[model samples]
Target: MAIQPDSAPSELAVAEALKALGPPGLLTGCRRIRGGDEQFLLPAERDSMATRDRKARAASGAGRRIVHELLRRLRCEDVAVLRGPLGSPMWPPGIVGSIAHDEELAVAAVAMRSPSVRSVGVDVEPMLPLPPDLRAVVITSHDRLGNLDQGIGGRLLFAAKEAVYKASFPLDGRMLEFDDISVDLKSGEAATSSGRRLLVRCTARPRILALAYTP
Candidate 1:
């Protein structure tokens, strides 16, 4: 939920905003982390996250709940969504999606297999500015935020890069670092050193949400 004791109102608001921001043909959902989301995990999903701390598992479950729900929309019902190598979710066959969460919120997006859209990634962050200390590491020289919301520009860039990494890694197993990707906020695009390019869209409303997709 936005990380407050009484955040349900804004939590829902964030969810709606994220749904609206989703890329075309991508199903998106959000969850307010209630700290009991682990209870929603299935046996196989639970086993995959067994080694995580209580809070991590709960958060992971929250994300998976949205993932599962989205998958169902695509007719991929009851998939386990296991945590595979490098911590990425092993999505069901004929589908590609990504899930991410902030402290009190979880968001996911799913899309059916198609030649036009190979993979998708979605990330959420509380509507807060990225810490100044970490700016040096997160912002690349090629990145631009001109005319974008300056208040949370750094935070938005961070989310965009993270989304790009998630979307690109599946296309090629190439690992990426912060500087390995460049986000052009003004153009609503991102590129990775591994030669993958994605259209990135973001909104800073009840939260900072970013989605990256290859089409």
Candidate 2:
């Protein structure tokens, strides 16, 4: 969710946005997260990882905490969000979720532990110009390149495609590059490879946020 003019980015705002989606089992949250120790990790999560680096540990801690907090609110039992072979989150049985973290912000969205929602994804990124080296690979000629002159379009496109990939991956289990999905920034929607369409809703305040939900 986008931050309100009166406030900074926060969990309340994101929760409100998820509620507005009107899905019975959706729970969402965002945090200005920091790294911590093994205490933050569930036994299963701590044991499965191969890395012992502090920064990696901290990022994992923050993501798990945000997820647990939302489940706590929903009164659901806490379960570890393990790492899948492809590096995507392996949500517990009966749940569909997505998580993304940048240097300073971590955001997560989970469809209430049920079979109804097949997948859910949320991504947040700084509204900066796309780095030069990544331009050709991510931004296609079909996109409205004119927005690049103004500076926010490329980042939005990258973020939207990321959100779409996360939402679609569980079904297809295929990795997607930015060029794989085409987005209409003006409409906040993307064309999916499987002939189904995924809606990409975006909000930009301190950063750009895109959330995708698959049917």
Number of the top-ranking candidate, with lDDT as the measure:
1
Report the C-alpha lDDT of model 2 over 36-100, residue by residue, as the tens digit. Answer: 63467788887776778877777777677777766666556777777777778887666778888
lDDT of 2 at 139: 78
> Number of clashes in every candidate structure?
1, 1
What's the distance in Å from true for residue 108, model 2?
0.3
Candidate 2 Cα lDDT to native: 0.68
How much is the lDDT of residue 73 in candidate 1?
Answer: 72
In model 2, the worst 10-residue window by lDDT is: 1-10
Candidate 1: give the clashing pairs: 1-104
Per-prediction CA RMSD (Å): 3.5, 3.9
List, residue by residue over 43-101, the lDDT tens digit for candidate 1: 99888764768888889888877777777777777889998868888987778989999
Instruction: Please report how far candidate 2 places residue 191 from its true position, in Å.
Output: 2.0
What C-alpha lDDT do the candidate models reach, one value each? 0.82, 0.68
Compared to the true structure, candidate 2 yields what TM-score? 0.81
